[model samples]
Target: MIRGIRGATTVTSNEEEEILEVTEELVNEIIAQNSFLPDEVAQVLITVTEDLSATFPAKALRRFEDWTYVPVMCATEIPVPGSLEKCIRILLTVNTTAAQNEINHIYMREAIKLRPDLSSTKRLAQ
Candidate 1:
């Protein structure tokens, strides 16, 4: 069976390091929370809010993890009149036997405001 885990995070700045740090953190958390093995991940699709374009968030995620074999693609998120800024979102599809309810979705920073329900359900690291 295949399952998808969703995550979103906001960057404090558009700088390369800041983008890289936050993207890596969110991706790592999503993978850990679901106990997803690298080999089981089918692909990762990422989108960054229109205000962010300094660097591709996927590049940071790939470089930060031992997921050289995993496929990742990134694009600009659709711009809305009053949407959140400097945000990056991810949809990770992985091959797993876990049930839908077992999957963990993450929302952080300003992006947390986009989905308070999911954010409130998160189990953050101690």
Candidate 2:
């Protein structure tokens, strides 16, 4: 089965360092929580809010040793009115035997407010 794990996080600023740092942290938590390997990831779609333009969030995946072959794409999020700023969202598709409900969707930092209904959104200790 193919499962899509949703995750999002916010950066304090639009700096490249902050963007990369938060992106890595978000993806790392998703991988850890789901217990998945990079080879199992079919693709990763990343989107950043209009307020963030320092760098492509996808670049952060390169820092992962085994993620070299994983396909990733990055885009700009739609600038809806009153939308979150300096935010990065990811839709990570992976091949897994686990059911959809078993998948963990992580929302970290200020992005936790984006999906309060998902129990997975409960903030994990930093």
Candidate 3:
């Protein structure tokens, strides 16, 4: 079965470095929490808020040499009034046997507000 795993994170600035660093951290946490291997990921859809134009969040995956084989696309998020700024969101469609309820969705930084109830209470690494 194919399951969608969701993860979101916020960058401190519009700089490319900050965006890449935070995005990579977010993806790492998602895969770690879900026990997903790169080969199991069929597609990755990444989006950033309107204020973040310095870089695409997908670029962060380049840090992982094995992740190059996974398909990744980036887009701009729909701007809504009072929405979080500098946020990057990812929806990963993976081929896995895990039940939907077993999938762990990660929300970090200010983006945690997007899914407070689903977000884990585990302390995040600095």
lDDT value for candidate 3?
0.88
Positional deviation of residue 46's Cα in model 1 after best superposition, in angstroms: 0.6
For candidate 2, lDDT tens digit of each residue in 73-106? 9999999999998889999999999898788899
**RMSD after CA superposition, every candidate:** 2.0, 2.1, 2.5
Each prediction's whole-model lDDT (CA):
0.85, 0.90, 0.88
Q: Which stretches of candidate 1 lie over 4 Å from their true place?
A: 120-126
Among all candidates shown, the one with the greatest lDDT: 2
For every model shown, what is its TM-score relative to the native structure?
0.92, 0.94, 0.93
Better of 1 and 2 by lDDT: 2
Cα shift from native, residue 125, model 2 (Å)? 9.1
* lDDT tens readout by residue for model 3, 1-126: 999999888988899999999999988888888887899999999999999999878888988869988999999999999899899999999988999888888999898899987675442431
Candidate 1 clashing pairs?
none
Worst 10 residues of 1 by lDDT: 117-126
| Candidate closer to the true structure by lDDT (higher is better), 1 or 3 | 3
Model 1 C-alpha lDDT per residue in residues 1-126, reported as the tens digit of each score? 998889999987789889999999898888778887889989999999878888888887667556998899999988988999899999999999999987778998888888887872455542
